[model samples]
Target: MPAQPSPAQSAQTQLERGNGPEPSTLDAHRCQEVACGNVLRDLYEGLVTEDAQGRLVPGMAQRWTVSADGRTWRFVLRPGLRWSNGEALDAGQIVASFRRAFAPATAAPFGELFDALDQAQAVQAGRVAPERLGVSAPDPRTVEFRLNRSASLPALLTLPIAFPVYLPAVRRHGAQHTRPGQLVSNGAYTLAAWTPQANLQLRRNPRFHDAAAVAIERVRFHVTEDAAAELQRFAAGDLHITEVVPPQPLVSLRRRFGAQLRLSPYLGAFWLGLNTTRAPFRDAPCAAGATRCDDRALALRRALAMAVDRDKLTRYVTGLGETPAYGTVPPGIAGYTPAQAAWSDLPQAQREAHARALYRYAGYSARNPLTLELRYNTSTPHRRLALAVAAMWRQTLGVQVRLRNEEWKVFVQNRKQRAITQAFRGGWIGDLADARNFLAAFGNDGPLNWTGYDDAGYRERLARADAAATDAARNAWLRAAEQRLLNDHAAIPLYFYTSKHLVSERVRGFQPNALDRHASRWLSLSP
Candidate 1:
């Protein structure tokens, strides 16, 4: 094992080397908060990329070919690859890693991506033998994957970051990778030293497939979760890159570092979710009923949606860097050309009236009102938004709303357990640039489907998209699925996310991905 440097020592080393100071990596929270794709881009190489228009382009594997039947995909592994551990890279490891991902009890979060593989679900469910798994490596250099359906299989692997293919030594030790000795990265960089909750140090991997092209020699990540503290540190010129800045700090930084202030629209959406399996939401007729109670509830939701005012929320919470969303799909997503203006153009009165009519058609009256509970993350912004929406519901529909705010982790737990109050918060990052990423969140059986909305018609359309062979045809189904959600009011779009950052002018070659992961491989710090 390499001798690990203490956080202070490592950070000071970077400073002394005139590379500025690297961002904190305290919680391994890189993927959650910052543009982690940049970090991953530095660490791993992949097969394809999403162009500016969100189309897939070739990456590590160059170009691939699919069998005439679309059942088999062949990827010719790049020659002369090596793991950071000094082991020769081969196709066997790739196939082995993917097989493990599909193995029963593994339950890799990305299991769904392999659903197109023949009998993958059955194998994962233990209904079929693992031997029936649909991937094969003909030799140490050739990889082929068999799919149950024909579609853009390569696009699925086109995610910006590598999927962390496991080496035999690392996998043999089991699921823990806490120390430098245990970590064997195949990406552009390898863990040289790590101190949990303090600092993580990465060094250039000479054995990496593209080592010649990697520019950064060493990278350090410090864990700085406190937003205010982070901004203060950055302002003192102690840090090179930072995550989010509160409005106050943003104002100051904008004045001091005008050109350094960077903002990019995020390919994610924040929204509210109603659990449809329970109570008033369970019965289609009751949910659709035109009774005064249902009518009031419907009016209340629409009014709250209008009154919450995303622009105000962003200004207060996100420094007005984010674009307020009117639909589930992000603006630049394929098949989502904004035919009209923003949803803000839809008059509040008309929206409220439409809500009332929807309730009336299902069975409701304006004379009676419905009372419901709303849940939010304990963050001040979410709580404030909840309160504002509640007030609007009361004024517009004469309905009573109770607000419940829980810590962020607790809120996530309740949502997963379906113990949420009447309504709670939800959002999704774009896995792919297609509307399918957004639509996949609504299916009852999906991982992100917090709303418990299960419509046979919607599922039918989703399946069609999954089964689609051509890019154009699949995109059509994707568009239909999103339109279905909008017409049914399945989920309300709060806003499209935009990442705001203050980068030092000295940091060069740092390009941000819409998916919110920062890659350090493509970056270099100047003196």
Candidate 2:
């Protein structure tokens, strides 16, 4: 283990991340939540990773080439690689990790990513053996992969799922593989300490291939959700970095912090999703003898969506540089154009009136109002949004809404298991700068499709878009597909995201990107 820095020295190197990442579980393969992703990125190096500018950069796989058919991808591993435990990190270990991801026993949360590999479907379904999956290693330093389709795989591998797993540790310790003593990381940093729902501290990994390039000696990420409280901590100098910035003090913080107060566009959408499998929210008529179950539920969805004043949500509530979102995918992603819902064209009054009419026609009134629960993770902004939107639904359409919130970790678990019974908050940060990354999640059996929206026609549009020969043609198909989705109101698009954070002046190499990703390894402190 590396020697610990003194209290005075640690103060200069330590970074305080106010309540964003929750270290619920450290096993990256089993954990899909961003909290775990943040920890894993610090602990492990993937075959590929996005640079500070959000471009593809080499990680474990130093360089790669594609076959003439574009279906076979080969990569060369960096020689003399060693894990934090001093174990060799070679192509064989990489192949084994990928096989584990595809095997039926491991319920890999991002296992959907493997579906792109050849024979992955059969391997995942238990039809074909796991060893038959399309990963091979001819030598310790060479890794080869055969893809089922033609796509730029390096970009996909940038996701956390593609990060190499230290198999020696995992094979020895099953569930507790990532515990402090058991874990072996090859990244710039390794887990030094984790006090759940409190703080996670990371120390520089001495065995990292390029540890000399790393600047920050230690990073302490603190769990903080309240924007106001985090701002206070930032002001007190107790926190060197925090993403939670209060909207009320934006103008003042700009004056005080100046360049340190960072506000940039985020390539993400904050929306609300209605569970399509549950009773009133179901996509088809329930067997409970209600004839208007399906049609009326859809009408109710559109009515609720139409009643929202997106402009107001973006203006007063968000108060950052966010925009009203009528579509799922945000603009600026490659091959994407904004798509608007039918109600977007109507005047505010007319939109509300139409919503009211739909509400009444769907057999919902203040006397017998359609009651539903809206769930969100613990955050002040979410509470404010839910309250404001609930007020709108009541005033515009006489719909009754109840707001519920839980810690982010528990909420994510429930959401993934389809335990959320009604509408829940959902925000998607693009894994890569592609429209397909956002729109592909809604197709039939799409991994990110939490709404349970399954329409053959909509799925066909996505398929056509995926199969299109040209970017323009694919974008057209995607636009039509988005229009259909918004028209059906599968999920209500509330607003786009704006990354707001505070970085101390002492911190260097903090380039602001749309993805808002700043790896601790890239950061250094000025003496």
**Among all windows of ten consecutive residues in candidate 1, which has the lowest summed lDDT?**
15-24
Provide the lDDT at 527 for model 1.
54
The local distance difference test score of each candidate is 0.62, 0.80
Alpha carbon lDDT of residue 214, candidate 2? 84
How does model 2 fare in lDDT? 0.80
In the range 238-340, model 1's lDDT, one tens digit per residue, is 7777765545546676687787777777788878776666754553345455564334333333444554556655666555467766677787775555321
lDDT of 2 by residue, 1-527 (tens): 99966888876777666647475577777766666776677777888876777667888888999998678998998888998878778899889988887777876756665556889878877899989999899999888999876667888787776777787788899877887788777888898887777788888899998899987888888887776778888889888888667766467667888999888888888899988778677766467766654488787788888899998888887787789998898988765786888778788889888888888877888789888898888887888889999998888887788888988777777766566658889868877676777766677463467787877778889778767777898889988888888888889999988888888888888777877777887778875
TM-scores for every predicted model: 0.79, 0.94
Score residue 350 of candidate 2 by CA lDDT.
Answer: 90
